[model samples]
Target chain A: MQGREILFIVLSLVACFAGLGVVLAKHPIKSALSLVVNMFSIAFLYFTLEANMLGITQIMVYVGAIMVLFLFVVMLLNIGSDRSGMKILDLKLVPAILIALLMFSLISFQVLYPLFGMQYPVADEGFGSPEAIGKSLFSQYVLPFEVASVLLLVGIVGAILLARRKA
Target chain B: MLEEFISNLHPVLAIFVRIICFSGIAIMFVPIQVWWERRLLGWMQDRVGPNRVGPFGLLQPVADAIKLFLKEDHVPSGVDKFIYYLAPILAFLPAFALGGTMPWAPAEGLYGLLTPVADINIGVLYVLAISSLGSYGVVLAGYAGNNKYSLLGGLRASAQLISYELAMTVSLAAIILVTGSLRMSEVVSYQTGPLWGIFPYIQNWNLLTPTGLVAGVIFFICAIAETNRAPFDLPEAESELIGGYHTEYSSFKFGLFFLSEYAARFVFSGVFATIFLGGYNMLPVRWDILAVDFPGWSEWFYFMHSANYWLSPVAFIAKCFLGFTVFVWVRATLPRLRYDQLMSIGWKSLLPAAVANFIVVAVWIMVTNLYGMIAGYASLVVSAIILLVLYLNIKAVGFNESTSTKRRIKMAKFNLKENEESN
Candidate 1:
């Protein structure tokens, strides 16, 4: 395999392990930190895909801002490691296992089916430039972009309303 | 032979050499900054600074480093061992990496060999992203120490960083709009243009323009807060939090924190210098323009212009040092702000002002693009007048409402007294 492919494989493995760490870690802070690792590895994956702008945005928005908030809340609450009294054979485990299997099968099918005759197109030189992204965002995808912005605005207003005092 | 060796070096080795040089110079500045701050602070407060050590205490930091290394590296009982070990590294790394995108000199010719380790397209945002990561170190340090004061310091740091980052990014967004690019080199080159696109004899430093001046001031304040310097140094407020996040840290870990803090200050000062103070140009004067405008002194002007071009690294370092001095001056001049005051400054004052400046820049750019320069100026004046009038009207209404409410409260009190008497 080429060096780039090797690098990609390594990054993907790291990302997968970090994702597992996020789920399996007992402490909430550990899980949050694992999620940060997962996010950073995914950003590197984006870099490998040559989507530089998207990769940067992923790091800046998710790992930098959102995960920081997750850590902030976790640290502020001072939560301890999970030590619940529930037994291993709880009824809830069955449904959770079923759902997990369902998700795994669905994702695997989509991945396996795509491997048969997939062909990827080469991206142009300016494919991931900020100017290119801006142009497409404002011109071609303006409607969806505006809708997403409005949704964010609604989210902000809702948050403020929920946090406001009764008076 | 040396030139040939450098030019023909492998790409990977070249990058390694460049990074080593960049980091070596940056780390070297920390000791000097430490000495400068102590001497300056002492002078300001009327006392002798570190004069007993080697030659005006120039070697004090080296002595301190040795002392810290020799001290016992103690860990408090009941602390999270993993994160406690990780915290100082996290704090130190991001601060060093923040300097990655800062251009020391023009990215051409011989001077381009060692500065700006990474000249990425998203330079400004990269800075923001890295600086945001710095708070994690403080927050994690606070949490891992398992001390009340450390936890409080961590909480404060996270909140403070989040609040100030908004204003910082917004103010920088105004500058981005003006420069029309996010690359650090582009931002610096934009400043090297004619002052306000009119004055040809002077370089267009961002501090000289109206909107740029406001944005620069806001960015400077936010940089101070981001670095956790005084008066915004709440995270490690010694009197209050007892060294804050590093309270339980000792020996080398604490020394790491100290090194990171000074390095961050030096880097942030360099960033400020690059963004606002005409990165590496010796003066705000365009010597080339002088050469063109004056034929009699053209030979002397040409010589000076070439000197300015070649000696840019010195100029850049000088600017960074000047900016560092200002940081110290402000630290000495201002008192630690109360928590509420700090929050209010970030949210109410800096954020709003930055947003207003952003809008002004946007409007100016749009108007200038559509109409000509004269029309842009006219639109600016008209908009300013309209905004002023709107502000006055709002103030008047608020004043009337407040007075009426007060009078009503007085009347209600009087009525209650009369009712009691009748009963």
Candidate 2:
């Protein structure tokens, strides 16, 4: 393998370990922190793919904004420590895990693996620039983009409503 | 011999040299920055702050560093040992790493590696991401300390940073719109020579543009809050929270906190200078005129032609100092904001203004492109009026929180007889 490929492999390994850490850690904040490590390594993965804009947005939005919110809520709530490792394997969680894994495998085959005569991805000139993304977001996927934003706005309203105390 | 030495340097080695050399220079300035703040703030506040350590108190930071080193490192029995130790390291490293994306000089120097350590395509986002990570240090420090005061400080820090990040991001979005590139060097190069590319005398620094001025003002405030400087320093307000998140920290760990604070301040100012004040381009005048007007200086012009390589770095430093002075000046002048006021400003005032300014600026650009300059001016006027009306309506509707001081005055029900007899 080339040096860059080796680096990518190392980064992906680290990212996988961090992802496991997020699930394995008992303390919510520590789990959140593990998730942060996951985000960072994934951003590096994006960098390796030459999707710098995506990598940076990953860092900025996920690590910076989303993780801050997570850490904030975690700290504010002061989650009690848990030693219940078996609780995660309880009956309720089993179905959830099975369903999630099934979905993941299905998508991996149908979309990610290029099973339907699909070609692998490559970075072209300006493939992952802000301008490129902006153009595509505005032109090709504008409706879905606007709809997603509206969904987010609704989520925000729901959250506010949930958080507010009755006067 | 020097020219040969410079030319012979390997590209990777040159980058390492620049990174190490630039950080060394930046680190050296920290003590001087501390001294400058002391002297300047003293002059401002009518006090003689720290004149005994050395000439103009130059050796004070050295003395303080030594003192911290000599002091025994103490760990509280109740604290989380590993994270407690890791907290300061977490804080200091990110502050230092911020220099990674900073484009210092032009690439005219040997091996074209003299500018910054990492000139990644997403330079601005790198900065934002690193800076966003800064809160982790404080939060972890507070949690590991196992102290209530520390926890409060950490919580405050996370909230404040998240709130201001929105405004900061929006204002930065406006700058990105204006520059049309996320690359830091591209942004700087766009600012070269004349305001708005029309006026010859005025520098084209973003602070001079109408849209730029609004974004710049919002950005400056957010940057200040981001660094936890006054009047937004609720996280470590000494009078209330004691030492705040570092209350349990002592000796060198405490010293690390202080060093990171000042270092982050300096670098943030450098960033401010780069983005808004035109990095390393001293005056916004075209230099070709000088080469044309006088043939004798042709060689000099050629030498400096690789402007970012040598000359611009010095100018960049000068601009950074100017920014640092503003930081100190503001610290000396403004009082620490109350927590509620700080939150309200970040969420209510700055965020909306930044978002509106960004939209206006974007529309202004579009209009100017479509129907010439006159339509741009007309749209600008219309937007200004609309913004003014919105501001008034928002204010009238009480979006700005009540600025009145605390309502509960602790006075014993105005009893004059008892008050007089107490003496």
Candidate 3:
């Protein structure tokens, strides 16, 4: 493999391990942190694909803002050290595991089926450059972008309403 | 020698350059800032600080580092051991990562041999994102500790950060509107010329311009509050909450908390410099002058052509130091605001002000382009009047007097009942 490829492989391995750590770790905060590592690795992958803006945005939005909020909620609730771990597992583990596995299989089937016959389109220029993304976002995806903002606004209103104490 | 090394081993050497540059700044600044703070505090308090540590306390930070390293590390029982350890790393990482985006100085010389670290285009956004992530460490520490005070501190921090985050965002939006870009470098460049006001004869730099000065001042104050600096530092208030969130921490873990605090200060200062002080632009009119007299010098002008290439890091660091000085100065002078006052300031005062500022700046920009003159001074006058009126109203009403009287009466009744029982 080329040096760049080798480096990529190493990073991918680290990312996968970190992701596994996120799931396997007992503490919720640690799991969240591992998820941050996973986000970072994904960001690196984005970087490798020359999606510079996407990579930074991924870190900024997911690893930074979302995860901080997640950590905040986790800390606020103080849910980590309770002896209710076994009880929680007993209540939800079997169903959750089954649903997760079924979902995973469905996704895998869809992905694999697509890969077998469909040829990936090759762009004349690089696929994931900032220019390409910007073009797509402004042109074909403009409606979706505006829609996302509305969705975010709705989410914000819903959150405020939920948090508000009834007078 | 550097050219030879760069040519011989470009890729591997580039990675090394990034690592060295980022780590060097982070590692060196931690100690230097510690010492600077100590000396500054000493000067302020009329006392010699750390004079015994070595050469008028020049080596005091080094001594402190050694002491921290040698100290016994402790982990309290029932704590999430992994997260407890990981929290500090989380705290310190954002500071380092956020430094990636700040354009310290102009790219200098041909081939640009001296960029500090990552010079991404979305530099401002990246810094904001990374700095916001810093809340995680404190939150994680508090949760992992499984202590009530720590949890309270964590909750307060999260709320405080989230609340101020709106004001901060709004403030940044005003700047972005003025600069017409999200890129830190571009923003700095826009501010490098004298801002022409409504009057044709009157022009000044943004710092000197009325609206710009107000925006800069608002941003600076917001930065201080956002960083949880004193007067707004209710999260880790020492007197009330006993060291606040990281109270259970000791040894290197505690050191990490301290490191993150200083590093965040440094990073925010860099941000302030990028946004307000014109990044690595030495003077407001330098670019204009470079274009006019000795136009060839434009090629060699470090602040203009080669910022974010060579001198960017140095300029960035110098700006960061200036920021640190401001933080330290504020810490020395300002008294910590009461918790209720802190909340009111964030929600009622700053939030409204930021929103107003954003609107005014946006309208001003639009109006200036359309009408050839901005009504910014009018907007400023209106905002000032509204603020003054609000302040007066708040002073007039005061706290809930009825509730206070009721509580006092209840306390008296309880004392009388206790006396009767004793008799």
Candidate 4:
């Protein structure tokens, strides 16, 4: 009815379609690109929700950096050859379909059923600011924060070792 | 008429005017930048440059654009039709949009926005997001062109991003820590004082601080890489790739890539100037401070005191041009780096250095603020010792030196012992 709501709906549809495109696209690169689109639309959704910091972070980390790396790997591998050998009746499809159905039902029952058609509340002051996040992260979630960083450092070291051992 | 224009200008109308003016400034400067780089490069290399086309080849870019316009646009047989057409635009748009967050000038008087356009809280994040998105243009162009050279160039460009961007962001994080804000205007304003808290005599440009200087150097190197400038320009090493990502493009599409490269260079220079050098401020001291502390000298140095009022845009442009000249100078002076060396510097040296310097600065800030001068000095001494140790180790060993292929020497005693054990 209103302009903001209309805009929200449009972005939601874009996110949904891009999400579907990620799963349905034949080429891995195309799927990766669709995932990128989905990420950007989610960032826009964050913007509409007035979580400016979160929205920018989503774009900065996911769409800009992470997805670029994803696409780079995709391009480097040059997987242009179509690998659509599996038919609809393939046994591999059954487990995947069953898992998808379980996820759908679980999400629908737990989240969608309870929260359906409810208007989202506006964010409070400094809800998604760097200061807000930093304070909480340092105070309440310090263990998790430090652990995550250490984990990342380990991964980086492992990557260097893997590369260096070859040389 | 002027009064009427200012009397009740609507917000939307003002924004439109500002957008038009911003874009107009950028568009007009592209040719000038191209011409300036050409002439400067010529001067450095001892040649006349493009003096034949127009007055000092001022109109050379215009001629080139027209020629490109008239040239036949060709599409090769193997290229992806849709993506090939779409690639140029993706390459072009991001460069233009990258200039959005920069505070070129204040919006006092008849100018539109009071702060910079898009002065959102997450100014730095917005900039990082948009500039990082620039790699897409290269990747798409290289892939769509369906040429091996183009694809290699594109892949190199993305790989380059993965190496350099982490260091770049870490260096900027140091600056943000020092400033306590991410806004460009805030960063600039913070620089408009002493070099550090203690040094009242020196301008407080971030370049003067110990950790800040290290961060500044790292930031500039990363900027050079981000813009894909020489000597870090492995993506478009012409001798190797034969025009690189735009190898398959012809006519105006090729022109677009050329244009975007220069524009992005200029914008990145603006960003560097803003973050490190003090955006539009010509000097560190404020007018009020000068007038109060030494009124007689203030009259003689009116230009220093009054740069912030009306000359911000001019100051911004001059700084950008100076930065651009440096970019050109480096291009003329340095050879293109080998790809392995490029990666080595980005990951091993710059990244580690940036991370170390950032932690040192953060500790420096915390110590200096909470405790007395003694604590601050102690922290400084500790960091300096650590730096010295690291430097000595690096000197003693080597950078990215691998030694797996060296021949192994057998010890005589160990060999005899092993023979006895076997027997």
* Candidate achieving the largest DockQ: 4
Per-residue lDDT over A8-114 for candidate 1, one digit per residue giving the tens place of the 0 to 100 score: 99999999999989877888888888898899889999888888788888988898788888888888778888768335688888899899999999987989677
- How high is the CA lDDT of each candidate model? 0.88, 0.82, 0.73, 0.82
Give the alpha carbon lDDT tens digit for every residue of B1-423 in model 2.
Answer: 654664578866766776787688778888899888888999999999888998878899899889988998989887878779888988998787777777766545442455677777677778888888888888888888898888889999989999898898899889988888888888887777567756754557898888888888998898898888888888888898997889899998998898898888888888888889887676555555555666798667555555634567688888888888998899888999988899899988999999899889888889999998779878877897899798899897664344322222223444555788896
Q: Return the clash pairs for model 2, or none.
A: B105-B308, B106-B308, B106-B309
User: Which residue pairs collide in model 1, if any?
Assistant: none
**Model 1 alpha-carbon drift over 4 Å, by segment:** A85-110, A113-121, A164-167, B1-3, B384-423
Which portions of model 3 show Cα errors greater than 4 Å?
A2-25, A48-51, A81-110, A116-154, A164-167, B197-206, B287-316, B373-423
Tens-digit lDDT track of model 4 for B1-423: 653574467866765655666666777789999999999999999998988788888999888889988889999998778678878898888787776777886545543253365666678777788888888888888888888999999999989977898899999999999899877778877887765666654567887777788998998899899889999888888999998889999898999899889888888888888888787766565565666677788775565555565778888888889888999999999999999999999988899889988888788878988997669768977996898698779866753343322312235566788999999
Compose the digit string of candidate 3's lDDT tens values, residues B1-423.
775665466766775776566667777788889999999988998888778877878898888878987888888898878777877887778767766756565544422344446556666667767767777777777776767888777777877777777677777777777776667657766766555533321224456665566667777777787677887888788888787788989878888888888877887887788787777654454543554566676566535544434455566677779888989898999899988888888888777777777766766666667665535456556666776687677766665666788899999999999999999
Per TM-score, the best of the predicted structures is 1
Docking class of 1: medium
| Distance from true location, Cα of A29 in model 3, Å | 2.9
Model 3, retained fraction of real contacts? 0.62
Q: Is the docking of candidate 2 incorrect, acceptable, medium or high quality?
A: medium
